[model samples]
Target: MRTILFAALSAAVSTSALAQAEDPNLWLEDIEGQRAIAQVKQWNAATEASLTTMPGFEERRARALKLLNDPNQIATPDEVMGDLVANHWVDADHKRGLWRVSPLSAYLAGKPVWRTLIDVDALGKAEGKSWVWHGANCLPPEYQRCLVSLSPGGSDADVVREFDLAAGKFVEGGFTVPESKNSVTWADRDTLLVAMAEGEGTVTRSGYARIVKEWKRGTPWSAATKVAEASESDIGISPFAVMDGDIRRVAISRNVGFYAARVSMRAPDGHWVELPIPETAIFDAVVSGQAIARLVESLGQLKPGSVVAFDIAQMLSGQKPEPALVMEPTKSQAIEEVAATDNVLWVKALDDVSGKLFALRRQPDGSWSSKAMPLLDHSTVHIAGTADKQDIAFAAVEGMLSPTTLMSVDSTGKAATIQALPAQFDASKFSVDQRFATSKDGTRVPYFLVRRKGDSRPTGALIHAYGGFRAAQTPTYLTAQPYRSGPLGLFWVEQGGAFVLANIRGGGEYGPAWHQAALREKRQNSFDDLEAVARDLIRTGVARKDGVAISGRSNGGVLVGAAMTQHPELYSAVIAGSPLLDMKRYSHLLAGASWVDEYGDPDKPGDWAFLSNYSPYQNVRPGVRYPPTFFYLSTKDDRVHPGHARKMAARLSADGNRIYFHEYMEGGHSVGADRSEDAMRAALLWAFLTKEIGSGAD
Candidate 1:
């Protein structure tokens, strides 16, 4: 996952004013440095000692672990190939998880007779590598030969090895892509379109593949043929292929930056043809000679947020561009995801914050008509899987207080609940409310409040805001897995505390315009939105000003870091996890350079002028009375450099702030490498929250 890198300083200033000397803690950037590791150990010991001294720390850890390792946890539903249902699950029994499968019949019957395809735990022990299951891509039609990816620890970079599903084993001497930030796509059973690091000079400055190569079966890595290459200014080029029935199309997306790309398709003649699509539009699917896409900017008559298609045949013939709109979402709506199912175009969208599904089918006139797929109210509806060339799709629906229910929708828009999760906790006693907080700019930002029913003035509140990356924050049981967060927050919700999820700006709540509202220099608006939500909660008496705790991971961590510094009086505690706090130096760190589009290029003096205004690391002052903050990051987090948190915590400590730091050895950009690690982290979070806010269990 890409972490958002933006934080705030109170005054407007230039990067020239905040030089490297101001951040003397830069030495901590040496992730594995002996001195840095020693300080991390010292800080971890102090934090664990203090928080563990709080009431219910041990019990909380035990309960959190129990729920995390629950034997009856829902197996996340995934479609292996259309004919079979599969899931990658991790629990106490399978620490490293299992890539297991079941027949479609058995899966739809609710008792999937799961057969393990890959025992990750066993494989890791045998290989002596903490192999994290990255993902897999199987060949089309037959879908037997697979390219399985495994990451060491939990880094974004992974190793891909070809596996034979029918034989249930790794293909001996088969196709393999060694560990790197590589992408391997099946061009055919015997050939692969690979984008990987060739050597020290082959990777982009952003630490991704700079060249696209083709690797055929039985060919040595040194003998692979180069297909395409991108400039150092670009992140990289990735190979993409689509197999729509007998029709197959292969292409590469040259990602010039984080939000921009130029796509070129390999025509039947084997020549690359550039499509005249917008640089920021997302390529969805190709069907009936039409190139389908979702636009990021208005294209002629078609507006942004419109799912449209143009004649691929016309483009190839160099004819004047003519486009057809498939779907257009309203200002309050955003297309969350899109898929093509044989004869139907599946669109799962969000209205306000509730999920609504839609299907577009071709009309006799060659145009498309859309119909709503009736879904549950106040619930999140996401496409779980779509059948191949079949007008059938699986949708998962869940709410803040509801367990997920996997629903199947056929071509006729008929829906059926195939699997419904049993409630993980007793949510019967809790109530959920969708409220709006008017920001300083007078924009109404939506947020969900989950709290105990009746006479519940929350003793404490956990307010969360992920206000960047255009990622939508939705309603679901706070289960971080199963596509999400649950019983863990139930610990606080049941204790007369409220859990608040703020749908602030710079998110997909209101589509592209909402996200664009806080881009670059305007990022302070997102912080304003979050502060408004906290103030609203206190004004409504849902939580005390001093009893409200804020938590954000990644970009959300950036939010917390800014909030704690700018409005420390609003929150009593701040939890920054896998955060990007030092805005000025972010681009100089690992993979941080790629995110210059999201957070602005600090090296450029113009971008740095605004960046210096809110950089949390530079904003830390000795005189300020800040909240006790807990900072944590993964040493293996290559995507968002751990140095962001390390340097920030070190500087804050030097400035007389009550700060605690912990760096785990594994689990890249995530809370943990395994279940127990996740549970322990949760326990520690709750411990600190309780220590600051007095448990809130009136």
Candidate 2:
């Protein structure tokens, strides 16, 4: 498991060897070592005792949990199983959540009568496993059977089970795959295309399934027919099934790397045909007779980031196919989503980080034409559900000033709001604005400001960002723990505090070009972009100089850690969660090697030179006047080892820096399985920020 470490360590230079020799906190990376656990307990107890007793901790925790567990909260529409809409929900009464369905008629009545398909809590308790629902994919036409995915303890790997949706039970003697980053799709009612971790040495260097197998009804996976295999140097293969009414196609996607794929589709007479598509293209589906794709690279005359369509029949038969442009994005625009309905292909684009939708349809002369679909201004429209049999598709609309509203649309591009959630916060007192900050390289970075509606500058500001992995920070109404953009607005903005979302380089806000510019060696641009945003807010007097704080989690956590270590005087407080601080050893951690495609292989000489200089753990000095910092992580964060947070906090404290830290007992990468735990974390985060960013500097 972590074979990349051997290769990376073999290339370690004298400087890296010396850095490790001098590092005293290496013992913290032992993960489950007894001494490490003891240190974690000491830090957890110390931080919780003070943070939990804050002035508004109780109120904030109660409010966040209330919203999370409220039964009235919008039941986000997922799939169209039958004449009913399916959803997965968790509330105060149901901790593990309920996978339920509501008839379209009942749903339209504004009081959906939900019928429980499976009570996950009950299922988990009976099985004695902490089962977190990943998702389900059912057989088409008659979606009576489904392949259900459940994560144990909320890691990336998940156990898959075949279930009888109509019977509302796990299918006896049906397909059941043991957890190891499993991927299973329905090839038919009695057959499945699966790629999973099976025999010894069967996983990729990135710790994913290397083999694709075809499993038939009533046969054990061990006895299944082998279909394909991904090389040890490649990131594992995944099975893709696309349905176009009566025509169904099954393709095995061999991921050459994180960003490239070579797709081979099963042909008419049970043979495989390699579609000559750009490796960076996403095979959406066969719309009519054409195979449509959202390209990360240009295909023929189609520009990168544009949706294009090509003849599927010709390509499947190993013939050259011409590409026709579906939707081309302007420089300020970015492709958000590409989805297919029964009769049309829908492309969702972000114009200046706002939302817009377009429909691509085939003309009478065999060419394609696109029309701007009517959608509400200033809101994001997410394709929620679609069926090949029905022309109507579902989308969820949300914005900074709006709660999520489920919308239904027909083939004519007409949309209607089927369900709407009442605003959670009082929008009358707050206003939303977008501003751009020029970075050190003269790159203009966008940031969203959500604060009180007044001419006066905000007394305090909390700037948040995640400028890695090409994950864009878009404005939407959400009350979740991790992506707390909306929660920050609800919890902090309403309290007379300012919230800013920075769209820095290394993100997909502007497009792939924005992200590509900040990858690997040029990763410093992301930090520079973030610093520019903070400086702009303060210089413009929108945020108090002494009352400015920064926060992020995962990759974003590294961003906060870097900012605090590199420029401590600029920030008053820092909240770094489940971060990758020690880049020198990051590749050795769980799932860290997989990200070498995003952040270059540290074993390489060129990559190590830059990574060593940018790593936060190595940069934190004994005399650095760092801001007050709070670090948080789950004891079982298997994705990013909790050691990163542990060692950083320990080193900071050893240097006499004001450090606050908490390590939850369980919860994998997310750090909280239930809202109760999530709310407590949120309370502590807000409390720590409030404590560090005190009265206004003005």
User: lDDT of each model, Cα atoms only?
Assistant: 0.79, 0.78
lDDT of 1 by residue, 1-698 (tens): 00112111111112343554665676677777788788888988998998777778788778877877877666656554757777898888888799988887677667788889999989999999999998778776788999998989987778999999888899999998988877778888999999886656677777677788888888798888988998877887788887554677788888888888888888777878888877898888876677788888998888888899877767766564767888999888999788776677788899988999998876777689888887898798888887655567789998888888888787687987777877777878888999999999899999998888884455788887788888998877765421212244777777778888899998888888888988899899999999999999889989886788888888887788888888877888888889989888787777777788888999899999999888888787778878988887788887777878888887777768888777788888764788777777777777777777766644
**After superposing candidate 1, which stretches have Cα over 4 Å from the reference?**
1-20, 317-320, 456-458, 481-486
lDDT over C-alpha atoms for residue 479 of model 2: 57
Model 2 per-residue lDDT tens digits across residues 1-698: 00011101111112255655787787787777799899998888888898889898899888877876766677766777657778899889888799988886666556688889889899999999898887788777677898888887766677888889889999888889887677778888989988877645777776677888899988776789888999988877888787765677888888887777788888888899888888887666677777777778766677878877778788878897778777789999988677775568877788877877777778877777777777788776777776445666677788777778887776677877777887766777888888999999898898888777874755778888889876787877635423732254467766667888888888887777888888888888998998999999988988887878888889997788888878888898988878888887787676677788888888898899988777899889878779988888887676787888988988888888988988877677777777778777778887787777853333
Candidate topping TM-score:
1
TM-score (C-alpha, index-matched) for candidate 1: 0.95
Candidate 2 overall lDDT versus native = 0.78
Worst 10 contiguous positions by lDDT, candidate 1:
1-10
* Per-model TM against the reference: 0.95, 0.94
